[model samples]
Target: MKIAPNSRVLITGGASGLGLALVLQFVERGARVLATDVHEEIPDSLRGLEGVSYLTLNVTQDVDWAKARDWVTETWDGLDYLFNNAGVAAGGRIELSEMDQWQWIVDINLLGVARGCRTFTPLMKEQGSGHIINTASAAGLIHPPRMTEYVAVKAGVVAISESLFHELKPYGVKVSVICPTFFKTNLTESLRGKDEQANKSAAKLIDKAKLSADTIAARVIRGIEKDRHIILTDRDGKVAYAAKRFARPLYYSMMKKASFQMAKKD
Candidate 1:
């Protein structure tokens, strides 16, 4: 999984956010990237980038994934890395969160990653050398209140990556799950919920976060280079995971306090 020059990489959700960040970094490193997003036309940021091609791919659709798989197999012959970075955010009190909303997020966030893995895993297994990096969130590891949909799907991503890690290990393929906390990104473009206040709170955390997508991408690249299984891209995320692991009482207290604060805002 060394990201060498001319490395063949496919990234989903490449129009914006961490996906775009990874695209830019990988391109700068001289990798050939097929940066796929939902936009029909090329995204402004990727319009004229050399060594990067834009492909319209909605991760939720089976047809789109089939097209991607064919293109990668025919054009590049094989892929070096598959970045399952497409996802959306959803939040609300459990009772207020509708079934449809829950299903929508599950389709895009959890099943989207699942589809990517399913489609490309066999390709990698055949090649015997490839990497899959999934963009799971810190919410996956440490669940807070009011983000059940997001948390559930992200935790699913973590589970998927961990399972694939052992499954693909013997074959020389690598797997890494990125569990990043709030960061500066446009991940909120897809945010939705019945609770406006709770939705805004979720968006605000991302808006006010200090770490830039590039910084997180850099850390992720490093982690992938070392073949790390779980990558916490920020200090807050690392501490939270640690707190939840060995200090359960303290972690529960902190989450409870935060829940009350969110309730006050609501």
Candidate 2:
């Protein structure tokens, strides 16, 4: 699953954040990149990039995915990499979360990946070589409070990627799940929650995150090159993941403490 020069790559949510970083990197590496987002207009930074095309794609819609697949087939004849990076952030306790919010988050964050996989996997299988990189979150690996909807959907993304990794390995297609901590991204701007104070606290946490989206993108590229299944970007994310794996009770305790502190801040 080496991303060589002229490799055809498709990235969702490519207008900003991690997706934009990936688009820049892939284009710099001589890969032909199609960067898709829900926005009707391409971002100013990516508008004139060489080896890159901007397209409108709403990941939650089946028709949008079909159009993307057709575009790839007609333009590149095949796709070598599919990055399921489009997602939105939502927060709130599970008990306080509304069904509409859950549906919206699930549609974009979880089922979006599923739709991309279903649409592009066959093309990858036919070509005999491809890779799918899904963007989960550190929250997916470690349960943090006040982000129940986001965590649940991201956990689903991780689970889907794991299943795909095993199922697609024998077929020359690699699958990797990226579980990264907060970074300088517009994800916070899209945050949906009823608790204004909790949202403010979450935004503060994001502002304090050390890694940038570019750093996360670098790790993602490395993960792809090495075919690493679980890609963790930040040190905190890696450490938290390990804690959750080997010290579940400790991890839970820490999360509960953090949750209580956030509530106090609110």
Candidate 3:
């Protein structure tokens, strides 16, 4: 599970945010990397990096996975790590979200990770060594109010990653799940234009919350080196998880109180 200097790695959704941070870190660590996003135009800064390459990938499609696999096999001869980090964001309570919104987010966030594992894990298994990293969320561990669909999908990611970890162990593949409270990323944009009023209100609340992308990336790299099963990016995340585990009734009571306050205001 150690990512050696010359390891070949592929990352989905590497065009920006956390994926971009991972690509930068790995490239600096001496890994040869191929990154992809559904969006065209890889960032100019990353274009000239010697050991890194970029491509357009729509992770929801089987054909896209095939092309990514072909590209890595042709370029690197084999793959050492497949980071299933591509994701989309959605904002709204379950009842408020449109059906298409639910479908779109789940397809891209949850099922996309599943598809990546399905198509690429075998390639690594055949080679006798590889790693799979799935990006879940702190929301995955606890279903907070107002993020029903997102929380559910992320929870599924954690479950899928844990299952893959055990299943892939027989094949010498490793699986890790990342759960961060909130890091500065384009995921927030998923709510953009969906519901401007509610989004602005949420934005104000988020602006008061403090977390950094650079810090999260650093932690993730370290976690990967250690082959951690569940990588937590924030101190608050660890604390929150522990609190929820040992004090379930208190946690629910506090959450219910907060919900009542919000409702009373509404």
Q: List the candidates' TM-scores in order.
A: 0.97, 0.96, 0.93
lDDT of 2: 0.89
After best superposition, candidate 3 residue 248: deviation in angstroms?
A: 1.0
TM-score of 1: 0.97
Model 3: what TM-score?
Answer: 0.93
For candidate 2, which ten residues in a row score worst on lDDT? 193-202
Whole-model lDDT per candidate: 0.92, 0.89, 0.83
Please name the candidate that would achieve the greatest TM-score relative to the true structure: 1
Q: Order the candidate numbers by TM-score, best to worst.
A: 1, 2, 3
Per-residue lDDT tens digits of candidate 2, residues 110-141? 99999999999999988888999999998888
Sort by lDDT, top down from the best = 1, 2, 3
lDDT of 3 at 221: 86
lDDT of 3 by residue, 155-202 (tens): 999999999899989988989999998766766666633555456656
List clash counts for every candidate, in order: 0, 0, 0
Q: Any residue pairs clashing in model 1, and if so which?
A: none
lDDT score at residue 5, model 3, on the 0-100 scale: 96
List ranges where model 1 is wrong by over 4 Å. Answer: none
